[model samples]
Target: MRLRGVKGSRNIEDRRRSGGGRGRAAGGIGGVGLIVVLAIGLFTGVDVTSLLEGADAPQTQSGQVSAQDEQAAQFTSSVLATTEQVWTKIFNEQLDRQYNPPVLVLYSGVTQSPCGGASGATGPFYCPADKKAYLDTSFFTTMSRQLGASGDFAAAYVIAHEVAHHVQNELGILPKVDQARRASSQNEANALTVRLELMADCLSGVWARNVQGLLERGDLEEALNAARMIGDDHLQRQAGRVPNPHTFTHGTSAQRARWFDTGYETGNVGRCDTFAAARL
Candidate 1:
């Protein structure tokens, strides 16, 4: 967690200063549908692109960035840069392929995105259509206060998980999964989505393994706690709903923490392959 003097990434687009205009839901959907999409996206990392198709977003006016905003932006850029360094080496040595890093868009409230209009309500998401990771810094506050997932390492885990999705996109796993989701039943598609998200959790642990030097005491615990808090089962119970395995999009708390530990213990990309495993 020692990030002082670390070089921040220039690939970021800071939109926190802008006033993101409020608009109706995509495809003219009602508030209920938008809430469902946003709620699912908050923890599950599901692609809401289809739900946001043909949506129009209002223009935003540029404003000023406060000092606190600047700090968060710098921290985010640093985490992203670390991911670029680690993943680039991983792709070359492990897969013999080039790694293309995705842009991390720092927005507040709401912002325009190729996948759709992004807002803090949806949490952080990776939009494959635009190859960008959209994040709202306020989510960090929510993570600490509401979810009890505190610490910089927990925030970094969130960013790394989104970047891991970009890794899956580069591996062509996302498109294939999307196609399969289109052809399968809702429950079947949700199952695939769960696997995809758990794989990202594993990949984040792989990232943690590669960046051991950057980690310190209690860092791994922060990330593991974050993973546990954000699990579908945990979130469902928090919302006062019964935890239904059949409706689960992301895995259970145990599944998430276990997969992350699997990658961290093995420290091998091959070991992080969730698809090949009969049990996840």
Candidate 2:
């Protein structure tokens, strides 16, 4: 990873330390239900616009957070900046268009996103409604300790995946998908969600491919491992539950890895049309 002198992104909005308040689970749902709640936010990018509407979040109280965590914030911002550069150049050279910059929000506990009032539990999400990416840096620690998805690149992939949704939104795919999801059956809708999630994984791979110099020998593997670790199947199994196809959202581990590999190998946005596949 030759990122020695690369410019970090200035699009970061840090709201760590003091947070507005805790987010309450709507109905005190069970594990599977809670997983769905978290998974939706994780997969399609958080709906900041819908989520933040009417949710009251007070100003954060003043308290010094860890300097180490602050460094992580800067690192996340740098990866974001690199993604912006990669996407912009790719769009201009390949598609004859310019990519608009999306704001990245970093918060602790709870913060307001264009989608809605964001809680740390929402994970990292990109709200199409507001076009901003929301994240809580503490998830990095959780990723390493609980999720087995460690490393800066693993963390960076999380952000990049959300950014990929932003790209999808720019392509006008999101609205169509949203409409289709609403009209489709629950099973069919989950299938579409799997495609959407896989495509985002592919988009992250596209970002990684363009930033070749920024990746090391095991970096890609770490990211791939992270991807596999977080698949719905893996998450469900880890929770000691049977894998149910009807409830699956992010697709299987192999499917996720394959799509991600697809993007990395092709590095072309057109090749990432997961929606057109006969099978994912």
Candidate 3:
């Protein structure tokens, strides 16, 4: 993706010094899990307990942010700006409304949110309570080294996907889904969660479609690779063979590809409805 001369979003809050500090009560989640939380929240409503948590405890204080910190800040803002432009046009044409952008918060290790306190290890997430997308820039490195996902576009995909959650929130899809999940059984909730996440992946594809003219040759592939790399199946394989489906949060590799392709190919949010689909 060519992001040269693009405007950085003004809707950003910098808090990079907060290390992925341990919270009073922490939940275990990985990069792939972060995607699931973000995705399902768009269509299945967010899981409050499942969403807030991290891996390690980093110190939260000054002197943690370096000069390079500002660069990451600017890059995140620029990527967010692109998503804003894409979604703005999408909201107007698709739903006949102006897209209300969400605030992007940059935090270090862990920080407090309207939803709860999250560690950097929890990855990037959006808090519907405060209408802000929280990110710890260090995760960009983690995306490549730990998640096996790379490229600036991959990072952009993460941001756009989270923004897609805000879109769902704005449309009231989140609250409705949240209510449904609360009334569901464990297995049922997981099923609904899968559908929701796939939809977010599809919605990310919608963003990609809107920016078709702006992407380079490998840009789409990079985003797809990100999806593939972070699938529940992929993470399971990384963990070990004998993967359990019951514990799977995000869909498998094939499902991820299919949903993402569905949105990008049609560029329509209506077609990205995962709940209505038989197979997620």
Candidate 4:
């Protein structure tokens, strides 16, 4: 959480000045209903392309950026830079390969991606087709206010998790998983997604472990709490619904927190092999 002197990433594409157009309700779901859906998607880090497929194109608008928004942007860039440094070293030493970092696209409201349309509803997601991570910094505010997951380190964890997806893509795990998912039943595919998501959670912890010196007191707790809060079970309970194991795209709260701890404790990429684990 001590990112004061950290350098910001030059890989950032800041599109906040050119607004991504005001979002409108999709499929007759508006107001609090829509927000709830967005919250669920954001926390679960699920690809909500189905939710956005037929939605109208967002109108572009211009707006002045708020100071708080600017600060969030800066923080995001700093965290991304740290990930770049940590992962670069990891690739060279561990994988014996070059690390090609993904661009972090900072957008406001809604944006377009090869994967689909990204709004606050889609939360922060990585488009494998483009190999970029997209984020709406306001989701950080939503995390603190609504999800009860605050702190800069918590936000950093979210960014790292998305970037971790990019790492999966770079390692060719994503393509193979996608192919498997396509050939799988709905339940089987969802299970594969859970492993993929939990693996990303673990990889994020690996990044956190590498940056241990920069972490302050309670930083790890903040991240673990965030991981717990965003678990599919917790999100289901928060939504006033009973948790259903079969429908879980991400793992349970305990599983998420445990996997993150696994990476942090070991700090080894091999330790994050969720796909090979008999138990997740």
Candidate 5:
């Protein structure tokens, strides 16, 4: 969590001042559904609708960054740089290939992505089409105040998880998974989606391990708590509903925490394979 002297990333595209001035299609999504989708996507992965949407809208642009926004931007850039380093080493040492890092786009209220036009209402998501991770940093505040997750490490976990989706894209897992999902029943697709998200959670843990020396006390717990906070069962219950395993696109709380722990403990990508687990 000590990010004071670390160098941030130059790939960051800051559009906080620009506002993007774009809106979602009418009747697209509301605040309540947005919160639910966010809680789901934060760790559980998003529904296919949001993931596969190809609605591209024109973007209007300009402005200055505030002190608070500037600080958040710095922290985000630094965390992204750390992911780049860790994943690069991982790709070279484990996969015997070069790691191409994704752009981390930092936007304010709204922005246009190749996948779709989104605001903080849609939450942080990775557009595989563009190989970019889009974020509205205010989600950090929402995580603390509304979602019961906090701390710098928790925020880092969110970023790392999104970056993990990019990792999946790089590894060809995403395309295959998408193909399978397209051919699957609803329950089956949900199951596959859960495995996909759990894998991302595990990948984030692997990143945590590679950066372990930089972590301070309680950092691991912070990430674990975050994983717990966004489980599908927990979010459903929090929304005053009964927990249904069949509808879960993300694993339960215990599964999420355990998968993340598996990666953190082993620090081996090979061990983080959720697809072959047979019990995830």
Candidate 6:
């Protein structure tokens, strides 16, 4: 992605140097399991409080911010501004409504959200309770180093996906889905969650479509690879477990990529109705 002249978002809440430090080591989730959870929570609006409960209390102080961290912050802010512009126009033209953008919270290791305590291990998530997306930019390092999903566009996809969740909230889809999930069986709830997540992936593609001028060659593949890498099936295999359909909260790798492609090709929000589709 070429973001040289893009304006940074003013709705950012930077807490990277706010004295908060990384939480204790993953207690029971273990390193690999933590990564799996992180993959699942990436770009997801689902509250992962229970999965993150094992982390010990956050430390009171943090190290000095490095130049690299500052650069990441600026990049994140630029991507967010693009999303704000894209979605605002999308809402006005497509939905005939005003788009209220969500605040993106940039934290380092750990931060407090209305939903719960968050750490780097929690990955990036949007808390519907607060209507804010929380991100520890270090996850971009984790994605490249461990998950093999690197590239500026891949990172932009992450931000767009979280913002997509906020879009779902703005459309009044989340609360109704949450209510249905509560009344569903475990398997059914997981299925619903998958639809919710896949829709976000597709919506992220919609954002990408609107920002075509900034994208470069191979950028789309970077995002698709990132989507494939974080699929529940892919993450399960990474964790040395057999892929189980019943346990999937996010759609399969193929489903994610296809849905994203759908939105990107059509640039139509109506085409992203994962819930109404008989086949994923």
Among the numbered candidates, top lDDT falls to: 6
Q: Which regions of candidate 4 deviate over 4 angstroms?
A: 25-61
For each candidate, what TM-score against the reference? 0.87, 0.86, 0.85, 0.88, 0.87, 0.88
Deviation in angstroms for 36 in model 5?
12
Task: List model 4 lDDT by residue over 1-280, tens digit each.
Answer: 9998999999999887775465742332222111222222343433443323443222234666777778889999999999999999999999999999999999887676666566665668787777888888877877776677889899999999988988988999888888787799978977888888889989999999999989999999999999998888887777666887888877898998999999999999999999999999
Candidate 1: tens digits of C-alpha lDDT, residues 1-280: 8777679987898877666534332432112211122122354433333323343222233465556656777899999999999999999999999999999898766776656665655678777777888887767776776677899999999999889888988999888887787799988977887888888889999999988998899999999999898888887777666887777777888888898888788777888778788998
Question: Which residue runs does candidate 1 get wrong by more than 4 Å?
Answer: 21-62
Q: Give the C-alpha miss distance for residue 123 in model 1, angstroms.
A: 0.5
* Cand. 6 TM to true fold: 0.88
lDDT scores in order: 0.75, 0.73, 0.72, 0.79, 0.76, 0.80
For residues 20-52, what per-residue lDDT tens digits would candidate 6 score against the true structure? 767532342222111122233442333334333
TM-score for candidate 1, residues paired by index: 0.87
lDDT of 3 by residue, 98-195 (tens): 88999999877657675766665466777777778888776676676666678878888888888888888888877777677679887776777777
- Encode model 5's per-residue lDDT on 1-280: one tens digit a residue: 9887789998898877775543443332222211122223533333433332343222223455556667778889999999999999999999998999999998876777666566665668777778888887867776676677889999999999888888888998877887787799988888888888899889999999999878999999999998898888876676666888887876888898999998899888888789999887
User: Over the full model, what C-alpha lDDT does candidate 4 score relative to the true structure?
Assistant: 0.79
- In terms of lDDT, the poorest run of 10 residues in model 4 is 29-38
The residue ranges of model 6 lying beyond 4 angstroms of the native Cα positions read 25-63
Q: What is candidate 4's CA lDDT for residue 54?
A: 43
True-vs-predicted CA distance for residue 199, candidate 3, Å: 0.7
Q: What is the Cα root-mean-square deviation between model 1 and the actual structure? A: 5.9
- Native-to-model Cα distance after best TM-score fit, residue 177 in candidate 1, in Å: 0.8
